[model samples]
Target: MSDELTAKLDRIPDPKTGKGLQAAGRLDGVAVRNGVATIVLKVEPDEAIDRLKADIESAAREVDEVDRVQIITTLQRPAGGGRDKAAPRQASAAAPRPARQIIAVAAGKGGVGKSTVAANLAAALAKAGQRVAVLDADIHGPSIPRLFGLRDIKGLRKTDTGIEPADAHGVRVVSMGFLTKPGQPVVWRGPMIQGAIQQFLNETYWGDPDVLIIDMPPGTGDAQLAIAQTVSIDGAVIACTPQDLALDDARKAIAMFEKTHTPILGLIENMSVFLCPHCGEPSEIFGHGGTRAEAEAIGVPFLGEIPLTIELRERSDTGRPVAFDDGPVADAFARAAMAMLDSAREARKPAPEIVFSS
Candidate 1:
């Protein structure tokens, strides 16, 4: 039995480093008694706790002889000593959320490249060496799976902690597309939609990303309200074409976020202009700078603009986001993404400490 437990521990991999648990020295102490396995882990507070828990549970399941698994994690201070016993209780109560920041990319109406912007922004952030995740909360029109070429991916695996998210384009992705079949229309009512959004927040395994970009459904409806209540949204990025009609809806979107007390990070003026690929001439096909003017009028930062290029549409349709390839469109997305990050930084407050005691 002891040998079996050792074998199981040997097979367990460190979720952060992807090395075997024994190789990473994460499996410090192990004791098996009567088919129950007990393990002790010494980890840093910055380590991915959700991943660690999942790895241990997965290893335990692989060992048929093990009926149950117990894991205990202890945090060590930077001074090579354990945490002080007298640490303030308030410190624990003020624990920060998993991700340092969460930005929602939303639009007043569809066809404004909201999801495209969200996906590309997440990809560009990852390219800039920031850990990022994209949550496709557009239940009725989830395009994230297709954008990242994860349409055929399997459902997320459940561990002791929560459901694990899929990885693509160096960014973690969770989408309602993964939950329902292809081409199936989701006709869920308000309560059900709200419940699903809540599950995405509380149940999905997001690990410890630096930022999370939520692709909210287009509108200022019940879905938007549910997201506001479910997640601690650090800020919102409203996307709109430079058209009067779009700007009108965009203002409503911004107002909705403001009413919920979520900071408006900035506004993205998508489709601000269209450039002829061959002629190199720019044209305001939808009437330009309306979103920017609206942002300024409403007291929010104007992030940047993206042109309506043929390549942008083709790339999106092919499941190859423009951000993944180098070109004018890629550069545009990178700039827009950086601007959003800067706005988020300006809007953020210091994170509070979290304390966990056994």
Candidate 2:
């Protein structure tokens, strides 16, 4: 009976990785007595136990000779527990918490490719094997769904615990665009917008993702205030063109985050210059270095600059992100993502240790 139980345990697979549960070290003790089998297991602290329990039960039942199967689980230090110990405990406080990092991509005004940057950065992180999700909080014009080729997808539905997000390009996506019909304008008042934003954060089931990118609306408004009050935002990335007009609004956006106590991760200068595809020449179409100067003046990091390119506009118009293709633009966004991660790491506050006596 022990032999049969062992074989059955070998067949079960880990829910996250889809490998054998035994191979993943999910199963531990295996004992059998009088045609009954009992198994002990360890579970991931961040994962739901219902699924793990079901997997163990189904695997034990596979043994034809076993009359009954019993399972028990206790939280154990994961394999190579040193790494888990090194991670910030504040970042891992509880289950169903906000993402490990919440990055708000905001702009002083619209049309600076803020949404485009948010979508591409999320995709680039996903491509780099990081679990990512994008939340389009630009209630007036949610463009992330369109950017990820998910314009036709419907809004997420409420599950037993929370809302289940739609999947796109291996990244979970939730947006106001998914909720409203295409071409329909969101003409709701500030209170309505605030309610919607609150629902998206509180009701949505954003699984345990490494990063959650929020595409905020153009200006600092009541909707943005609602988001600030709702989530524990890790940091923010302000987007602006190099033009003076946009920089004026960009400063306000930065101030808003600072006033709300959200760390300013960095500033991204989009459309700083126009790069010619044929000649490989750069033109200062929107002027130059204004955003860098602003970053220096404000004492915030300047993440990077993105050149205005035809491919960027065309790809966004066609519902495919430029980051999906290999080029200078993709490289720029990749670097920006790394910079954001670095900034978040630097800003992380150590978790308070809990001491207990035996």
Candidates' lDDT values, in order?
0.78, 0.80
In model 1, which runs have C-alpha deviations exceeding 4 angstroms? 1-96, 349-358
* Candidate 1 residue lDDT tens string, 256-340: 7777788899999888889899997899999998988888888889888888899988888877678877887788889998999
Q: Model 2, 113: alpha-carbon shift in Å?
A: 1.2
For residues 137-243, could you state the per-residue lDDT of candidate 2 as single tens digits? 99888898878888778656778978788888788988888866678676655555655676677667888899999999999887777677567789999998998
TM accuracy, model 2: 0.70
The numbered model that scores best in lDDT is 2
lDDT of 2 at 42: 61
Per-candidate alpha-carbon RMSD to the true structure: 14.0, 16.6
> Residue 62 lDDT in model 1?
73
Give candidate 2's error at residue 355 in angstroms: 23
